[model samples]
Target: MKSVLLALCIVSVSFPALAINRYNVQAMSCASVQQAVKRDGAAILRWQSARNPSLPLYDRYVRNGLYCDPNEYAKRAYVPSQNRANCLVYKCADISDNLLFDD
Candidate 1:
């Protein structure tokens, strides 16, 4: 009974972490992406700006309904404008097949 309780406790502790899945968006520029992320709380895995390869992942201050214009800058670190309609939005669903939770 003690072992079973311990196992249950461990499972409960790790459940939240396991439920959360990181998401990545390919943006036209880091600034735009950052702005959008700041307003959306969406995790930015990488930013492929036109002027740079990629930016390091960082936590952003997201709000709600923040708009981003990818082509606003000539020199950008990412370029999601190339395929705005079909741009890839990376989420846990893309990486895993398990329907355990929604991030």
Candidate 2:
């Protein structure tokens, strides 16, 4: 019974960690991107520059859509230490998507 209780406690502790909400930001610009990062704790910046006159600028991009692909932005932009990832998908946001985990 004691062993079972210990196992249950361990499972309960780890369950929250596994349930973190991982979001992929799609087409975020430079400014609002910062705001999203600050608010959500973590975000993926999907960059899409406008070629035509009808399209919106960088500012509008952040406000309208979500970006995905941190590695792409980190290569060009200045991502902080916590955001920089050695792997393909860089952790661009200093905060974690997981509400439980404090930035």
Candidate 3:
């Protein structure tokens, strides 16, 4: 039992915890938000709703498709930033297999 517990501790300590970076879009310039995603590969961006100021909106943005899961693809998305209302960013989009080919 002691050996098992020691092995468990060693295994747990061997793997480091990974976390995604987050930023408030409203506090950053459009360029800054883009740069953050590019530098970090992915980030969680947050902003307030235009229609409902009290409501908060956020999503995970990626630098490219490499950051997305195999079933998801990177797509263009816009978010409000300090300098631009439609700051360009990439979001992971779901890939639907329902589309039929004409062939």
Instruction: Supply every candidate's count of residue pairs whose N, Cα or C atoms clash at under 3 angstroms.
Output: 12, 9, 0
Off by over 4 Å in 1: 27-45, 48-103
Error of 2 at 97 (Å): 23
Which TM-score value belongs to model 3?
A: 0.77
Residue-by-residue lDDT tens digits, candidate 2, 23-43:
322333334445665465444
Per residue, candidate 1 scores C-alpha lDDT tens digits across 1-103 of 9999999999999985454324344534445444554444444444344555564443222222222223221111222532352333322222233344533
lDDT of 3 at 5: 100
Runs off by more than 4 Å, candidate 2 = 28-103
Worst 10 residues of 3 by lDDT: 94-103
TM-scores, each model vs. reference? 0.33, 0.30, 0.77
**Which residues of candidate 3, in runs, are more than 4 Å off?**
1-18, 97-103
Ranking by TM-score: 3, 1, 2
User: Each model's C-alpha lDDT?
Assistant: 0.41, 0.38, 0.88
> Which candidate wins on lDDT?
3
Candidate 1 TM-score, C-alpha based: 0.33
TM-score winner between 1 and 2, please give it. 1
